[model samples]
Target: MWLWITGIICFIVAVRVIYNRRSGVCTSKKLLDGKTAIVTGSSAGIGKETASDLARRGARVILACRNVQKAQKVADDITGTTGNGQIFVKQLDTSDLASVRKFAKEIIDTEKELHILVNNAGIVAPSVKTLTSDGLELTMATNHFGHFLLTNMLLDLLKKSAPSGVVNVSSDGHFFGKNLVVDDLNYEKRPYPSTFACFGQTKLPNVLFTVELAERMEGTGVTTNSLHSGAVNTEIFFKTNKITDYMFGFLFKLMAKDEALGAQTTIHLAVSEDVENISGEYFADCKIAKRSEQAKDRGLAKKLWEMSEMAVSLTQEDHHYAGK
Candidate 1:
């Protein structure tokens, strides 16, 4: 009877601890006081939730979305309802280099600094092999290259914000990625169902970019990180075919989390005082977490970056985000 009572007491303590931790996380503490944040693709899904969460937390949010009108509407609603209207909206299409550069220049000319940059805008176009204006794979171009270019463009501003962050929203799907074919990143030689193979190379690029960025931005007071927001029931999975769709629909029933939970980790990093200086880490479950074996390989990360640069024809000279 004594042992049973001890076990019950311990269980209750553990449960209470967990409940307090989650409660503390969920209360919207307004922790991001006075900082400025730019959340890409804030029109919908996790991005939208992230924007709202940041705004609620006292971050001056800039909704860098492709749709200016929708972005403004969301911004307006956030400010009007919360009574914290410092939110700004700008048009940015992560898939297009020209738009990215243009947006960068506008920020440079207008704003003096940036605090958090969440590379959250991503597109999972269907199985079709669509190409960007620059003729790279659509998903790769939009999800990775676009953010890479944007980050490079805003490096000066990010550096100015010393002790800032650049977060690339990656995925667990990076586990499936293999050794990148440096000579054929665009699938010019082997383009599988762009959608089927999408989860692999795309997420791999995210990790690679984070690793490379952490190196490039060392000591600039800008830390970088990535995360898998879990199996979110967002539009990404909707891009799959009927068969894949039914399978995922069933799978997500067990794995999926709401957009609020999806944004939890992002908000945690952007504002939490403990992680203010933390960088080059990946997160899940509202905490810093480990990735797969492949994600741990710096060699793979370098190879992916080099191959990606070659594929996109990106060079230091092309870093300027000026007109077109």
Candidate 2:
């Protein structure tokens, strides 16, 4: 009888967990009537949901994605549901340096006011080591370096809009890396044991970039913050091995937050008045959270910044903002 009672209690607990995984909490419906926002990887998952939420608040949202067709469809859906037709789709493949340059150039040439920038696009580490066209590791190129370049290229516009915000979608997996090998960012010297470790390595730079960028933009009024959106049930884990993917799917179904919930912290940082003056902070569950020691290393942050400039070939002339 005791065993039977215990079994029933466990079953009830399991059901509650699954329910929460399916239904996420609603974010505050603060209006952003005239703001122009860019959300990379906005075609699906947290990116898509975040974009939708922003549109609902009357923001003109640009769904920057690699696949124009899918992005167009997402834009149409958001328009249909929200009755906000200000959504536009643009091509942006963050893994490629050329593509990043093209996208930034187009935005800079076209847009008048740039208010919110969400670097929400990312990929899980490849099962095997792969190199991008720019001769950098694929995961590092897509997750960190590409966004690094894009953000820097648009820094002037963000500053001009003053009080603008940049939201970086980092992950809790950053703690998995033992230490960042600044010299071997491409993982040529030290072989990664698994793609998970490689993924973690890239996330560290996201936080470090936020730290250093916030410092530079201190008086510029452009706040930059990073967040761990929680273990979300998204399509990122689908590209791995069948067995591994299935296991992750099962676990996520039982424990992961829905995409909407995962996007709260990102939306919080982007449009929340509470964090209007806040910068260089990491967030989780819509609150400021502590990051790993390596993430907070000021010296390492500066080193990474220099290395990123070298990787992207950013010159002094590229920096239009004198102080930044």
Candidate 3:
């Protein structure tokens, strides 16, 4: 009886693995031969896998990461394995506004075309309340605001390369926030119960940003969407205590999808012709997934867009392109 039970368990596990592998597959036939793609935080995890996938498909992929040395190593590995020398590394710290500006300027000045922008870099949550140099919550700043500024800065180029795409890697955790506090996004007024709740608040803005951006870029032929990459086994959860981290990591190894599998939706959004016309939608497992009602609030989305513009301090010229 024990032997039969063990065999049954093994069969179930094998079937589950096979099913997951078959689902969420990206069937993009479009070759990005002359196109350029930017994947922020591509030094490791889902970002690295996503960048490598794009490079394999003939796109001039740029690995935008905070750690130049690490990114360079990943770039080299990607080039060697994919035989796509077009992969290059660029320094970008999304939490810092100055760094974001410099990175965007360099890309705009150097790259002639920008077809895909994958805002994949994100942080879970700091154990304590951490503030960036910009005076905003670190998780919120990096996860949403940085990508917000970067996307607006490159809007013109994206328009020039019409039918382009902007893929924001959001999470189902956005539902944890319940509602967005547009007035106090920095947690000055109300305190968060835990770090996870704070992180969830930041993710809410990602979907909101995607909805508003797609609305603004309506006729420009640029599609913007957000996605939940599923529970991925990545380094983002290392901020906890060692014992807790170890336990969580072990569970993730058993339950979470690998980085390559987690990157399928992102890759699909980036290069799939099927979604070429789809915009302002939330996706999971490479399908149009439902989002929390808060994520679907148009008024909330617009309000957040305005607040984000203010937080980023967009210049008059930048506002022109941002439709402010």
Tens-digit lDDT track for model 1 on 1-324? 999999887875675455434522433364777788899998888898889888887888999999899888889898987777788899999888788878877888888778999999986545667778888777887888888878877877888887788888988777766655546667788755445466577787888788777777776788888887766656556655756665775555434565676777777766667676677788876677778777777777777666665765566764522311
The window of 10 residues in a row where model 2 has the poorest summed lDDT is 19-28
Name the 10 consecutive residues with the lowest summed lDDT in model 3. 315-324
Give model 3 RMSD, 1 decimal. 2.4
How are the candidates ranked when ordered by lDDT, highest leading?
3, 2, 1
Tens digits of per-residue lDDT for model 3 on 217-299?
98888999999988777877764664655677666666678889889999999988889999999999899999999999999
The candidate that achieves the highest lDDT relative to the unseen native structure: 3
Candidate 1: Cα lDDT at 129: 74
Please report the candidate that would top TM-score against the real structure.
Answer: 3
* lDDT preference between candidates 2 and 3, better one: 3
- The TM-score of candidate 2 is 0.92
CA error at residue 3 for candidate 2, angstroms: 8.6
**Which pairs clash in model 3?**
none
What's the count of clashing pairs in each model shown?
1, 0, 0
